[model samples]
Target: MDFSDLGKLKDLMGNAKLMQEQMEHRLSETVVEATSGGGIVTVRMNGRKEVLRLRISPTAMGSTGSDLELLEDLITAAVNEAGRRADEAMKSSMQGMMGGLDLPGLT
Candidate 1:
């Protein structure tokens, strides 16, 4: 390739690296929350997909054995939803960084 083309490629690579670093920082800072079972279970997560906190309503905890299984299900649903939200947040941030540039083979 021509020198100009090589220089442009290098610059693109550098920008990509910077974007990646910025994304990492943003993911660490961004937070998302999800709830399940009429908000009996709540989960908080960051864009990095790390769970920050989980909260269960006392009413969700019943003395019945079946209640334990329901509680487990609610917790699982809340956590999964939180993770999904985190993924979406990260994807949106990445798209913003890309700034509408249509890269081949990349969403």
Candidate 2:
């Protein structure tokens, strides 16, 4: 193999190791919080996309006229918000690890 090919292989291996470490760190350290129904419902999620906690306000439960609709809307909103937060966190963490380097087929 040429020296240049050997060098490229070394770099690729280094990048793979870096990416693995970064992914693990991100999974363990990142958490995102989201709220819906004007903060009546709240959710917390980890970087691994696991739901950590959920909060529901008493006012949200006590709404009598359209309780089911309210509940559905609140759940949808909270879920969407959580997803948004997760996407943002993932992008930020990946960007930091990547150091502005572009890797096709990786993202």
Q: Against the true structure, whose TM-score is highest?
A: 1
Per-residue lDDT over 40-96 for candidate 2, one digit per residue giving the tens place of the 0 to 100 score = 999998888788888888777754768978887897789789978987888877888
How does residue 58 of candidate 2 score in lDDT? 77
Relative to the unseen true structure, what is the C-alpha lDDT of residue 52 in candidate 2, on a scale of 0 to 100?
89
Every candidate's CA RMSD: 1.6, 2.5
**TM-score of each model, paired residue for residue:** 0.88, 0.80
Predict model 2's lDDT versus the native: 0.84
Say what the RMSD of model 1 is.
1.6
lDDT for each of the candidates?
A: 0.91, 0.84
Off by over 4 Å in 2: 2-11, 63-65, 105-107
Candidate 1, residues 73-97, lDDT tens digits: the string is 9999999999999988887777788
